[model samples]
Target: MVTIHELFQNDGQKSRIGTTYNKILYVPESVLQTIREYLDAQSESEYQGEDNTIIYTAKFPDGREMDIKCCGCQEESSWTEAVLFDEKGYQLTYTDVGEKFEGLWELEYDGIHYCVDVKPERNNSKMED
Candidate 1:
């Protein structure tokens, strides 16, 4: 499952003026594995990273594209967190549907918490609850 690493902090205020803020999530390796397997089953191609991370992307038969990033924390005993995006580069959210490996996530920026939900398995634009 995914958990908040840090909710709010003024760590790097000067550099990230108008761009994205700093937010981190701690996702378990098991969850990462499940996500990777799911992407692989969808025929997504994997991209290697210099660090212990892999990026997967694919354009579905329905013409929508998905991008997923799995990042491993060296200090956290190899646990990984995932960041998902669509073809337009918008961050996907995670929602807790009472499942073992599903949850919701919010990123705080400019004192506002924006919801980020996972893209549904189907090629629909509706957000998950």
Candidate 2:
């Protein structure tokens, strides 16, 4: 079994799936704070299984809600996670789905909130030195 610390380390790795963003976005800190607060208030639970991943829930200040889960690794550690968007007509089937939209993707986990700009994950277009 892996601990949370291991997960954070694995998340920091810069392999193929976890490379630098191909794009960036700008949003308000207030909005990001709101999502963080909402996540901080939620109860904790684990989705355990060979294929099942750990999931949690949060409520936005606007009364909106969403779900998040640690993307479990079957063999090697996969830093990607499973996230669900709560807005109407927005159905997310995967974590990378967030890239399609260009706006604020407010999320919270373990009592902390974060705002993700849904732009392309920026990457170096030119060779690095």
* C-alpha TM-scores of all predictions: 0.28, 0.29
Estimate the overall C-alpha local distance difference test score of candidate 2.
Answer: 0.35
Candidate 2 lDDT score at position 58 = 37
Candidate 1 Cα outliers beyond 4 Å, as residue runs: 1-69, 73-78, 82-101, 123-129
Model 2 poorest 10 in a row by lDDT: 15-24
Q: Write the per-residue lDDT of candidate 2 for residues 1-129, one digit (tens) a residue.
A: 111221234668643222111213432345333333333323223212247443334334433344434343334332333354445625443344221133444544433343434322225322111
Error of 2 at 111 (Å): 23
The top-ranked prediction according to lDDT is: 1
How far in Å is the alpha carbon of 32 misplaced in model 1? 7.6
Instruction: List model 1 lDDT by residue over 15-108, tens digit each.
Output: 3223222222234455555655533332223422236555344332222333335443323322223333444766554322221223334433
Q: Kindly provide the TM-score of model 1 when superposed on the true structure, using C-alpha atoms.
A: 0.28
Deviation (Å) of 87 in candidate 1: 17
Predictions: Cα RMSD each: 13.7, 18.3
Per-residue lDDT of 31 in model 2? 37
